[model samples]
Target: MSSQFTVEKTQHPKTKPDQQNLGFGKHFTDHMFLMNYTAGEGWHDARIVPYAPLSLDPAAMVFHYGQAVFEGLKAYKTEGGRVLLFRPDQNLERLNISNERLSIPQIDEALVLEGIKELVRTDADWIPTAEGTSLYIRPFIIATDAALGVHPSPQYLLIVILSPVGAYYPEGLKPVKINVESEYVRAVRGGTGVAKTAGNYAASLRAQEEAEKQGYAQVLWLDGVEKKYIEEVGSMNVFFKINGEVVTPALNGSILSGVTRRSIIQILQDKEIPVVERRISIEELYEASVNGTLEEAFGTGTAAVISPIGELNWEDKQITINKGEIGQVSQELYDTLTGIQNGKVKDTFGWTFEV
Candidate 1:
């Protein structure tokens, strides 16, 4: 039950880069939002075209069976020009739990949140009011049948792009380092690692390009059957803080349930601050960093909403946390979740959604 949509606008409009060097997802946003799906006529034509290039049919079953599913959210503007959207209905209920773990069909989370509020109100001037900048939405799905050996994929598409960003780790809040890998792994218990598919990040790009050639800014995944618990950190969702509480890692079906990791565990349980999920061991976070309580370490999603894990290399041993600094509860949970996502904090947990 979803139809009505169209908007063509954009007779070429490019030049928009330099919100003090945007970074993160390079650039993009001139209008985009598509929708198709065809198995006895289901999700029809919806459009908002003009952001080009996407011919797909080189035997497109997501280019040979990797079905695909995606999501990531953001779009804050509010210096008064209003454009909020932080919990986009929890990213379309986690993209239909990654399209039912990649079998791929189902998606109408209220017609994709009204096609993400009319494509962010028709690209609301491409968002970005500087400060830390944002407007990176994404939302994807693909499995376009066009002949492939894959068993599913009757045909599908679903786009939704827009990008305009900054700091998805070039060390914006500093503190990163990580690398506790212990020989790859990342996802077990019936796999597809809690489903944000696309071959679970194409199987972690050869251990994040060998932990970025030894400089380390990613790779903390452990537990594809006891590589000794831990789970994720580079693609976000880690968190430590031992003794004074706050621990994370317990959505086990192999992690990846992060809408900024449940809004940093509901803002550390609404500031009572004892947050605890369960099972977290790299020898219990290196014995709480050798009995100093381990203090603070962080990582959450929607692209670095709170990175902060200042050093931890393992197996050859190295540690450092809080002293490598960024704590104070990861700068007050990134200033109260970027101040309740750019409205300068006062959504009172309704979790924003203006557009």
Candidate 2:
């Protein structure tokens, strides 16, 4: 059993029941977990504070230099009314990895995990019990020292906020249209793309908004150098099915190694599906599509577990995948993924951690 963190809950004076229709990141719980860290003292002053605005100096290092890292995971209220986390240790480990890349000090993994559970328990009422709904946990660290110099801060603040989120595909798991980015690059070699840092997403916002303006749901980013290999989407990892085999871009220092992506690969491999983690080029994907070998394509992440890619649109070329609908492999992957997550199936991989 995980050690429990002491919580100081602040009751929301005027709170109402959240509508089930409220989508992801809209509704928040009443209390939040926080801790402060200093270079000399290390991590200390852990507490459960009220869900309120942060007090940061105008000349804070995070404001000027963008020294921030974040993690996204979920707390699920199981059918048995028990709150659980899916591979939270993996998220904690990834968060530290991201912190190292950002020059921030590492945090205690066990303490962070314990604090998250305590926050969720305090805000248990905020966790939606409906299917496909969960409490989205956002744990982040930010440089907090009031300094104008472009150097690492001597102090940092870590926080965990909980939000009740509905299904990514509220209506259904329909296919999404993706625009192949030719001009913009999300991450380059030796860049911070592999880490879950805010700068990466901040860099991709322009392309994402442009994609939305152009009538596409998301932009599929390619390698920065050659612009031929598929890296990832704005917020999810990409996967392609070619010749009845599962293929995803390997961790090549330019793409995030998503937890969902790893889980899907493990699930498929366990079921005797040929899973390959290699560099998949855009031209090869197009060729496979034209030859009827590219059976399906999808994006995987924590928010959107598995979203099908119906069509890929590039410069003056449009390729339809799986007849512009969700394929067998995509559906199976989604079902298995969600099933294991919601406790509807046996956790063969021991992914679930009861909170």
Candidate closest to the true structure, highest lDDT: 2
Local distance difference test, per candidate? 0.85, 0.89
lDDT of 2: 0.89
| CA lDDT, candidate 1, residue 226 | 62
TM-score result, candidate 1: 0.38
For model 2, which pairs clash? Answer: none
Q: For candidate 2, write residues 1-355 as lDDT tens digits.
A: 2334456657653373565686878778898888999999999978887889998889888888999999999888888887789999999999999999999999999999988888887888888887788889999999999988888899999999988899899888999999999988999989998899989999999899999999999999999999999999769999999998999999999899899999999999988999999999999988998889999999999998999999999887898999999999899999998888888888899999888
Q: Report how far off residue 239 is in candidate 2 (Å).
A: 0.5
Model 1: which residue pairs collide? none
Worst 10 residues of 2 by lDDT: 1-10
Measured with C-alpha atoms, the lDDT of residue 250 in candidate 1 is 91
The true-versus-predicted C-alpha distance at residue 280 of model 2, in Å, is 0.8
TM-score, one value per model: 0.38, 0.97
Flag regions of model 1 displaced more than 4 Å: 1-32, 35-46, 49-66, 77-79, 84-118, 123-138, 146-148, 151-156, 161-221, 233-236, 239-281, 284-286, 297-299, 303-327, 331-333, 340-355
